[model samples]
Target: MISLEEFKRSFKVALWFMFLTFPLLVIKVNPIERTVLWKWENMAFVGIGAFILSVLIRAFFIQKERSRNSSKNKRRFGYIGDEPLVQFILREPKYLYPLSGGVLIFALLFPALFDTYQTNIMTTALMYVVLGLGLNIVVGLAGLLDLGYVAFYLVGAYSYALLNYHFDIGFWMALPIGAMLAALFGIVLGFPVLRLRGDYLAIVTLGFGEIIRLVMENWNAFSHGPSGISNIPRPGFFGMDLSLDSAILYIYYLVVALVIITIFVVNRLQDSRLGRAWIALREDEIACQAMGIDKTKTKLTAFALGATWAGLVGVIFAAKTTFINPASFTFLESAIILSIVVLGGMGSILGVIFGALVLILLPEYLRVFSEYRMLAFGGILVVMMVFRPQGLIANVRRTYQFKKSTKGGDS
Candidate 1:
């Protein structure tokens, strides 16, 4: 049996050989002109080749390590016991604030650098971030698999649309009402499904989302059905109409403000007692129940809170588009939002944001290849899952620090 060290050395050698051979394989082929090759196909080929190579190398290393370990008795050992190296670094609380503050500052000040299209994409991404964060509260922390999150979003949009259309209410007043309505629906939905678990719960929530869509479609009396609501109101600034002048800039600032508020609320929730309980429930509901936590209340709160955020984003979506219909709140939308949460690393706030950004913006960035955009997007998702299953930003373990007293304390 090959020792782990020797196997690892051989694997490294093989990897270097593959790397050197890849260019040679493509060089003589001359499949297409260099200029045209640079446009798309060649780029994709190179990317795919590199990805495959990396995967093989990683697999080789893992297998080599395993093989070496399996025959440990046959190899001479250096010592009876080996201690792993441990490094402890003191991290100041201030470190977090700088990262968050810098991102906000850059986003706020650099509005002009981003084109109108990019700004629109960013708005959509931010909306998803809100949705993902809200869903994170439910599915990530509370362990609820909600498939009707987009229903709350629909409720929010329609709330604003119907209220403004009938009562002449502005976006500002309708925003809160929309959120409340969605939260109410969330609680209502949670009541029946609370008894169900796993697949049953997922199916029920999915049915609820479809029911909302069907209601919007068939109930022409209220939703306008297939035609849907049009000419919705845009968000304004203290009676200053965004439509009158630089609407994009005004909307951008509004979105930034909303994003900040969402982040603040989520961060606070994650640090609160409720947050810990939710996490405990996620790990094991029976254990949580044993600890005297009321499962019903915790689950309901998660549902309501998650729906509330989705509703808020709905209001923004309506205001931003100035129109909406049943089509906007489809199953695909829910899937995308759920994907954001999962791909971002369920419980991680920043991970969800990064996931939303990448998923939403990547297609827009690749618009030049409109025909192949979705295929490329799918490939990217596959690559990401295979490579970074933990997500773009892995969850950081929380380390509690204690200051030792000089009088008498163990360091």
Candidate 2:
């Protein structure tokens, strides 16, 4: 139902946007040529687009309000909303097994179906998938705000780059080495921020990341200054010489395997004792500690385990690109990773995976829009935050339902 009031509001919104973007979208100037161009068509385009967007947004809100009212009515009647579709499918083994098998089969055959470039893109997405899952442990389950997670990522990358350049270490051997080094760095970082929380902890982590990046940039002998290390070898396949495409496919399969392993491990960890401790710590540090959970140990383990995944992915990133640079591991990278976790529904494995794919792959495809792509991306994010702050698929905590025993029931 489109109301006249809504249309009036949308029209105002369109006018506002047109006015705001007049100089940029509707006008152009050439300095050397001494020319001015007035593009009224651009203004019209902007107005139409803005009006449509505003209308859609208003309609969405109206529908949401209706749903909320309905939900409240249902709750009063001792009913509840339906579970999310994915959760329902996952819970029913009949649906889950077939869906899982189909997905797995498709994933296994993806390289064959797609070109090398697509495979490369998927590999990057999968790498982020692992990174998101790792950070999920700290930020999602543990509720620790980390702004310098890229520091551990930086550590893993440089560990491989430096080790390979100096010691000629291979990928198989360097993988674990890089991951362990990152975990060690995580432990080091955890110690100093033991008492800090919220913004203060975030600041410390951000500073640590900046410090690491500066050190890498300035240390000429160590990290080759800003020129970066190039020609880093990709992961080898059983001593076989693979061409470029073959190497890409191999790496794709390898990352696929890594993503699976990461998902499995993270899922298991979420069900484990430490996982609960992290969740408790996220909920209430004081209460968690009062419950006899070691806050220090819990925090440290979260950091270490999260860093391990970042490190593993970092090494793969370096190997995949066959290059390493300080610029690659920036604060923006950390922000993007964090965004994936937040957008995907932190602490939810499936949500993280969905978020990774959308964040990583969307921009690539949006390249067609060129200059307008980032604008579109930012707009989508803003809309998402306003409409669904809980993320696309909110994490559903496991719980137990108890039935009253007939024999012991009170009369």
Candidate 3:
């Protein structure tokens, strides 16, 4: 509590923080009133706040880092995941099933409980959850780090939109075709780059995404030259069209069903033979090949499967918005999806739901800081990488500890 060394270190950190926050705190603009305010006092206040936060953070992290190397702490803590909250849930499916069921029950009754706006937000969150899960297959499960994943989304949306626009195809018919087209695109894109890894792979994928976007942007005949296809068919059962509230609720229920299906499918894959092959490739591609996992087949499957979900989500997005344009699908979209996969524990389904809820809904919560939302998100990603790269709710492996008897039992 009375360490001078700590104070010096904290003071240095505060100075750096002040340097970082100076621009943000020193300038304030009022768009409503059309006025600008300059206050040096605000900077001082932020500096003081930063100093305190730095001190506390330093203390906690330093102690934790030190404790990580301590055998006594390890013995005492055992597994941090074994704490009361998730201990029972992670260990036993008997408990996990009930918890999941309760959540499902609440989700089913959510629209009745909440207003339309909240329902829309929840639906948006579910869409993101699905997107995150889709990318999770490529980046999380396969460890591929795809930055062009949104290209598949665009392919799906356009496939559905163009099909419906010209042929008068309905949502149900367009959905499968859209998804299949997206998967085909995935396979086509995955073919050439099977050998690349890490940054090179990322750059190629980014280029692929940009190329697709540019094609959509410039192709005047096909995509209407960025005017986009409007009046897209709305979702309906039979010939009866739903009202606004009913439509939102319908989409909400529909996405909820899709999210469940996605979760089920992904969960099964993660536990199956192909899933094991993916993990082996992720761990060591050379070794995986030696062990008989086909690189081209596995990689293409990953891309195709991952793209399938993105395509499905794209179909839903088109129905929900009823408009399509090149601007809608961009590299930023891919970044956000990748952010969800990384911010959530990689390869964890529940973690993805949590990540989607946080990232997608956070802007709504921070509406005042709407412009700064991306800035804040980037900062959080940076801080998380620095402090806890594994993620907030990292998937933990179960370990069986065998304790040997210290003394022999007497006969």
Top-lDDT structure, candidate number: 2
For model 2, the superposed segments whose C-alpha errors exceed 4 Å read 8-50, 71-81, 372-374, 401-403, 406-411
Clashes of each: 0, 0, 0
Q: What's the distance in Å from true for residue 65, model 3?
A: 4.4
* Model 2, CA-based lDDT: 0.90
lDDT: worst 10-residue window of model 2: 72-81
Candidate 2 has a TM-score of: 0.88
**What value does the lDDT take at residue 315 in candidate 2?**
93
TM-score, cand. 1 vs. native: 0.77
Tens-digit lDDT string for candidate 3 (216-315): 9999899886889998877887878988889899999999999999999998898788988888888899999999889999999999999999999999
Question: Looking at model 3, which ten-residue stretch has the lowest summed lDDT?
Answer: 73-82
Per-candidate TM-scores read 0.77, 0.88, 0.86
Best by TM-score: 2
lDDT of 1 at 375: 75
Please provide, for model 2 over 81-148, each residue's C-alpha lDDT reduced to its tens digit, 9 standing for 90 to 100.
Answer: 45656777756789988987898899999988988899899999999999999999999999999999
Which tens-of-lDDT digit does each residue in 338-385 have in candidate 1? 888878888888788888988788767777888986576567668778
Q: Using lDDT, rank the candidates from best to worst.
A: 2, 3, 1
* Residue pairs whose backbone atoms clash in candidate 3: none
